[model samples]
Target: MGRWGPRLITLGVVIALVYPTLGDPPRDGFPLSTYPMFAVDRGPVTRVTTAVGRDADSDRVLLSPHLLAGTDEPIMAVRTARTAVSDGRSAEWCREVADRVARGPARVDGVETIEVVTETHEAAATLTSDAPPVSVALHATCPVSRR
Candidate 1:
């Protein structure tokens, strides 16, 4: 009975760990997990208003939104393209998206920089805001490896 006790406990622990993964897709699915590592410090996230405006002369679309970083101070903006880190075509797509965002208007006063840290085809951007140094992560899905 002594040996069996430990074995049963070990089995219980192993099952607890595997059960969560079995029921759902991995955390980084097409729709990523809400409980990401970076969202911890973002206090009271009020959804920013966004507008998709068209540049008639350039034939381009712009995405303008106001993001409120926890504090009253201005936050540093980080923009990423989906294809930049992954595949070549995706990188081009991401660049287009980034370009559109760059041209878009921002209501908040101090948006220091809009950097493309990683190209498309790679992981999403993990941005750290300046106001209170809050971290926000953007996630995207890619093919899972069989091997």
Candidate 2:
């Protein structure tokens, strides 16, 4: 009976640890996967500015230029959008970029507004021009545990 008791406790502990991981959401839907790093083949310019704002509201705009290696032109840009709720600021930015890409090139006279909000920051912007399709490449920052 003593040996059985220890075995049961070990089993209980294992189940407790596994339960949380089993309930975790899929990685594909995660923000990290959604916002992938892009590789550009431009000139010496390794950084480009990006803006985010809403289609109707222009007062609250966010402009951020991320430092990227390997390109002169702004080959890739990240667009982050924030709402009053939801904790996924990075994912929202990626989603907005994807939506803009799907909508095709912006008109010379028209404006593409973007808005970003997070626990840390809020940004908005109105972008113009016919930008190319931004390609996103996903890389895992953390390694998977085998144990």
Model 2 reaches what TM-score against the true structure? 0.21
Segments in model 2 whose C-alpha atoms lie over 4 Å from true places: 24-147
List candidate 1 stretches off by more than 4 Å.
Answer: 26-67, 71-147
Give the 10-residue window scoring lowest on summed lDDT in candidate 2: 138-147
Give per-residue CA lDDT, model 2, range 1-147, as digits (tens).
688998999999787655544534523333224222343345422222343333333343332233111123344332212221234344444444434433433331122343232222111211234333243222111111111
Q: Residue by residue across 25-79, what tens digits does model 1's lDDT show?
A: 4354333233444755544432221122233243323323232111223221221
- In order, candidate lDDTs are 0.34, 0.34
- Candidate 1 — what's its lDDT? 0.34
**Model 2 root mean square deviation, Cα atoms:** 18.1
In order of appearance, the predictions have TM-scores of 0.24, 0.21
